[model samples]
Target: MKRMRGLLVLTILCFLISSVTSLQAWEILQQSGFSQALGDIFFIDEQKGWATGYQGVIIHTQDGGKTWSQQKVELPCDSELYNIYFADDKHGWVTGSYVMGDGFILNTSNGGETWKIFKTKDMEMPYSISFIDNKKGWVCGFGNGTILHTEDGGKTWDVLYKPEKNYLWRQIFFENAQKGWVIGCESPQKGKFFDTIMATKDGGKTWQVKYYKPVADEDWWYPWSSIWFVNEQEGWATICKKEATLLYTKDGGETWTKHQFNLGSWLYSVKFINQKEGFISGNLADSGKGALFHTKDGGISWELTAEFSKSLRKIHFLNSQEGWVTRSNGYFYHTINGGKDWECQLEPKTHLHDICFVDRNNGWAFGKYERGGGLILHSEDGGRNWDKQRLELPSGDWQMGIHFMDSQHGWTGVSILGPNSTGAFLQTKDGSKNWSITEIEYLPQDIHFSDAQNGLMIAEIEGGPLVMSFVQTNDGGESWQVRNKVARDKELGGRRIPSRIQCLNAQQWWVMSSWCLSYTSNNGKNWTQKKVPDTSGFYFLDDQIGWFGSNRLYHTKNGCQDYKEQELPMPIEWISDIYFKDSQEGWCLGNRYYVGDSLERCIIFHTTNGGETWEVDLKSPQHLHRFGYASGRLWAVGDNSVVYGIATQAVSALGKQYITLGKVKTVLFQNYPNPFNPETWIPYQIAQDSDVTITIHNIKGETIRTLQPGRQRAGAYILKKQAVYWDGKDDKGEEVASGVYFYTLRTSDFSTSRKMVIFK
Candidate 1:
């Protein structure tokens, strides 16, 4: 189960990063106009604004918040994004942290169209970012008490202060480049806790404690959750102690006035358009009530503007009249009347997670609609507008895994609900305009297609933990059966899911969990295990050679049977994912610890001459995730819900012809594990849409089984450590004997033959 957590975290990181990755100047594509939960909202002007949330989510609206378009951010999609700040509609920055002890402060100069990452030096997750102008900003968070200052529009940042104690700085507001107020909390001992507000005059080079307040009655837990400052002299902070408390500061933090709320309310977000007006919202978790407070007279007193049952977490205002508050229920309340009245907006029916542009005008985004059916949003006008295309899922499911073989062929792995629920595998052949779904017993975390007939899928088995079933389909989704049950330990527990699966063709494969790697030479029919401390990312050139990433990169020969470790140019905590175009060229992405804080920094390295030498590709440590080789491009997906691709030929000339083919041709490769151990993989590809078929024949020419008989475009291999092999079984699921056999691939215009020997 711990192995499952690897991909589980990857999936979450994928989603978390999805929302923000696309923000590189946002182009939002929602599901029936609904996206996932929104975390923070910011307005650049009365008409231009941005909102961010789960999955690296950032939405931009140019039309006074009436319609929002999602943007594609080009950062690793694994960070927990929190706040949005735009110096202008063209220049903006967003801040967040990663689960892996790292944080992000991304900047955009061209209306969110492109971004440059100003990575935090310390591993502390930045919670709040404030830019006084286009060139000066401040960011602060907990973990060694980080408070960062930037002078050149985030081109570089200077650590003003990182406290010795492990205090969590939540929010930082800079009235000017030099005058700033930072708010956070700390715990010195078990029961002793206090909240603090600080002031910095030397551009964060020096910080002084301005005010400290203790939560009375031994609670020691009065921490401010949100902070806002209209100017240096006027600021407000919301508290989450025993009850929701609103704290106001005037005269440049010389004094503060506390206004207590109902004992059950926990006010979170505080936003003020000006010194005279502001609003706050929070959830009364104790009573299942949602509360909103409004103050027109600069926080001297407050009025209950609205109430609901859901807990509110964040609030934003575009002027005092045009404001929105996000809640725990994945919905938001809007007020055009200065909080005198409010209107609620439900969650969108379709919430997209990923978007890929084949070209400027052709692209596809994925998400789920309200009914829980996976959907594709296709754009033909350079992402200016999108049209939703609903998928016909097998059991009315939503997408958990999605991949496109091309603009035409794609797959979506979906999860079904209810007692009669089974997993769903969805396919799109018409460029995402339509879909066909198949019901399966497993829920795939990742899917791959070596070709149409032979492929693999790694999935979490239904019903239990650490109990994953591996399956293969020789007939391409017609039927699936267990190839192996990877029960690492019967006594093991938790959510350890498979993080990565690398196949060096069909004969050998590698599956990496969080802490271990399983290798198979017989197409996943048998396996060998090596326990690794942080085996999160890996890549294999063949059965005999591979690299596993942890604090350091390790190399294994003789098919991972044994390995030796190598010291990288710098230390890494764990690799998120790894990729290789060939044996000689590859890329490694992983995290390294920030100097003193447990917070982490992401690192990227590329090797051109196998593992003999390496060089850093990234300027410095920044959060990055899974990578791939597609269309002569090295593609990387990260925090920005954005997919970044670099020309493959530029970095590695060998990758110019990465896929070995003289020209465009359709050929069937020989079955993997050809000598066979009861099962082997047969892979074939098609250049165009065609009726494809695969048939197995005995030594005497008698038909054993027809693996495939259908029209095909392209297919997915097991993105994990599984594959579709014959398994020496007949059409009726009967086991066959040992012998040499032939497999024929037949299409409307092409035919090929391969031989395999199956031993039973």
Candidate 2:
């Protein structure tokens, strides 16, 4: 029996270990490769391929379009790889720009197991390559049809020919060693619809331009993007149509005819599987919205197949049935049934700001700035086009907030805290005009003015007993009033307090402090206090509902009457901020320190059922962080200025459980164990800290208590200051307050809460 039991226990342990291992896999919906700005893709088979892009990025796939992995390459950081050519599954070569030099090529012999670099003698960059076998190949770039021939599997190269000054050849192909053709743009810069095609009758010893059509005046600058040959007699070249035109030739380069493939964007690439079926891809203007056009009758007519929001930088085909297209965004799209269908492969992001999409059509992206500054950009279209815009700050001051009700009526808040610090309130009534800077009667930190008239400002003051106040205005920043006064030294043996005010309506407002949640119904007058959970992150949805998150959750219902604890998934020991769109959606954020003792991750949790159950959104588990919601998006900013945002509507059902996202509220609770003890407990709440003060006083109205004499953030506070621990004595150390005493909590918005206590 003992032996049997031992075997059963061992089997159980194995099963448990297997179960735990399976659960450890982190599964996301999808993942892409690092965004190296992909430039080319080549397939050896339908299921196996190689891709190349910027910064020497090479990705290989073995299972068709299902999975891909990065291939290692040793190239200088300054190199920009342009084209990849694979002879087999393991043997391949890539041509790219050099490290502070001209063009160089790299080749692998043992199925991409290793690579060798071959520097070519050319100032013009090598952009195109064709191989007859492992030992014979041709490349062209940066010249009027200058071709290089490589022997001994690309170990050495010899220049074949350098064409004239104004001609730029891009593609070269040969039929046997005796006949070949080269295609590129011609000179004179006008009326050149047909590209210059040269014929070499003697293995490329010499070349003659057999056919040249002058480029039209409208299409003078851009090159003839690509060319393909089925054999010696049949060929096709993709030419940018000053009109919607795709051209084909039947009898070598002697004659050309326009193939009808109408498109709004320019076609840059063309490939024919046979005579009847072919595919083409290119950009729509400069935007990434390129499309694949397929023709059934030898380029006679075409139809759109696949469209992309990223630029179709290059395309490669293993056969008529399978091909791949790469984009500038470092993504590879592969199609098995020709260009009829496509699947994408993602790339890693080299910089924090690599992809910028405005709508979907217009966007701008750059690889890297050599001078160590911002290299990425913005756009106006839906990510289809891009233009480089200078990164300049608006003239007047750094814009703190941008509020546009429509397009014309907009408001911005600016701070004059620079070296030219002036208390100026700048306004722009027109969409474009000189900004109106006015000095107001307030040294405020935050401003939330409604319309052009009614406004609320929070100010912190220092002096005597009172420390903070809220001043308001109703006449377009002309006059101000001391709506409320938040004084220190009134409650809990005269503990100092800090407070902040967030106006929900005009009359209903919320104040945040280190200790409690304080609510006001009539402007900032009469306040009520309710204790919060801990001393950190809290969010309010409105005047009645809010969420407090620290290690746990403390929720309030019915205005601010009560506080209750709610369970969370894990212990969020560093919650920093909370936001809610309504009563059902909310988010809480903080950081968790990793095992490396660094804040390598962010801890973001969302709740759907009003803080009942929480789901982890981000888990950096790193340093300190803060999050807030403006408009319909929640923005989280962190240590390195790492910003993250997600739409409020995109939140999952689990995310909606958090009802507190944006609004701020405050509450303060009375001290516990008022009767007698060496230690007592005092707690308070604040949504935000303008300035907060808590103080205790005797019946004679003499000040004896002070707590938190400065500003504080939203969350609960526990006061255990030894000074507030009276030896059952009054401010004079004598036993007092056996009847009743008073305490007050004050905020920077000039909102205060008072509580009465009795001593034994």
What lDDT tens digits, residue by residue, belong to model 2 across residues 704-757?
756554765544443454212334345566554333355666776544444343
Q: Which stretches of model 2 miss by more than 4 angstroms?
A: 1-32, 99-101, 164-166, 186-194, 263-265, 283-289, 328-330, 347-760
Root-mean-square deviation of every model: 21.3, 27.2
In candidate 2, position 39 carries an lDDT of 68
Per-candidate TM vs. native? 0.49, 0.45
Model 1's lDDT to the true fold? 0.63
CA lDDT scores, all candidates in order: 0.63, 0.55
Model 1 scores worst on lDDT over the 10 consecutive residues at 5-14
